[model samples]
Target: MDTILDALQEGRLFELLDNDKTDALQFLAHIIEAFPEVPAGTDVVGHVMKREEAMNTALGKGWACPHARVPFDEDLKCVIGWSPEGIDYGAPDGKPVVLVVMYLVPENQRNHYLREISFLARALENYPGLDKLRKVEDLDDIRNYLLDLIDVSKEPSGPDTRARMIRLQARTAPETLVFQDLSNLIVEPVTLVAGQNTEPVVLTQNHALFEWLDSVKDLIGRIETEGVYQNGGWRVVRRGAVNYQGSRIVYDCVAFKLIQNRPEKYK
Candidate 1:
């Protein structure tokens, strides 16, 4: 399976004329027309429209992902469109959608299709490249900016990039823990509170972990994991433990073993 960046390069990327006449369906139709290799007799626009009717694909913050599954020979095909003035996408936040990324995947590639959407959504949720994308006027520059954004997402977590796991044990309460990481791969913190007397509580600020896991899975597509690691592909490298403020807090580092071998590169 090709990475999202690879598929994007193989597909089309262009800018749309932002006007009072443009709507969601028109935007989707434009993308469908851009791809000529879509199998004959395939109603690409209808497929996408049907999916949209089922659920609004508009993700707030000026972004929308409209996808369709079709009878195609290839795993997937993508087309990214940018509208500077934005369009009324009926988003949850009621914000105009400025970016539309449409995916047309083969029916058999269910897992790949889902993974692609997940990655794209998470990548754009807090992407730092949006500002740069808005500034560039040329099509080639926009493409390069997207490639650079993907390159940054594919960066390997190094020694400096670490997640701090804090295990907090209270006096009467059983125990609670938090995983905080400043890695470029995931910038949010995951906190889990568990104990015998109290109900378990989980506080997640964002989909950072989900995004990282998906990216790693895509990087190691279909690879066998025999000697990868005894503990299921993840190895918790011990950093150290510490006691603080009436709680036993343990600090440890977590990383994916498979990612160490395969560093991402854009060709």
Candidate 2:
């Protein structure tokens, strides 16, 4: 459940275009192709569509989780398509599907994916916000809604990081990744450090802070910049770009947790 929710938190959530179930599934699958975790030349569409033909993935109550299995070993990644105007997804209960949570299952994460899905299944059974989620028009509302599924309220976002963490839900236009936490100015070519072992992401509207990053991106890969949402002194190793449905550029990075006390690192 946290994995799916975390995916949405890290900007994997998108407003789906109005179309049939196949189109929606393809739409989500196409997004999955852009994920850094997914291997290049991997036929995400082919695999998902082929699997769909064998068994329908339309989970009743406006949710459809279609998945594809890959041979590579990586984290179980997913992208969600939120259709405000539901699509006719040929559900067993004869209902339109609104949330399409498509997953890319890796060899190592099969058990983990199953566990998350199983937990999500039970949680959704009693989740009392179906009608509310159906009416969600803004990405901010949608993100906040899902994050609340498993309240991280207890997870102690210390005062030092509390203010920065609050901006994690960067507000955006209906179908755009337009950053708004910094007065909606912009975070173009957003370099995301995929918190594989630490905090979820590091997105700042202050591009000047990373101006040197673009200049040396080709020369060096994982040069740590002065912290922005840099929690627990983790090492954010830059991987590469992860282009999504929107025009916004995203990079996949893994943050390895470690303890440190470097005052000079903080700007």
Each model's TM-score, in the order given? 0.50, 0.59
Q: lDDT tens digits, residues 1-267, model 1?
A: 134453343434545543222243444453343344555446666778788889988877677778777876665666677676677888898877766777777777768778766765676765777667556675556655666565455433221121111101112333222111101121123333333343323344334433443344222211111111113333212112233453323222223222223323210
Question: How many collisions per candidate?
Answer: 0, 1
**Evaluated with lDDT, which candidate comes out highest?**
2
Check candidate 2 and list the clashing pairs. Answer: 180-184
Error of 1 at 71 (Å): 3.9
Tens digit of lDDT per residue, candidate 2, span 1-267?
A: 656655654667767654457666765675566454566568787889999999998878888889999899988888887887887888888888878889999889999888777767766777777667777787666666666544532223223233234345343334444222112111233455432333324454434434433333321223323112222222233333444553433554333222234223221
RMSD (CA, angstroms), candidate 1: 23.2
The clash tally of candidate 1 reads 0
What do the candidate models score in CA lDDT, each in turn? 0.48, 0.59
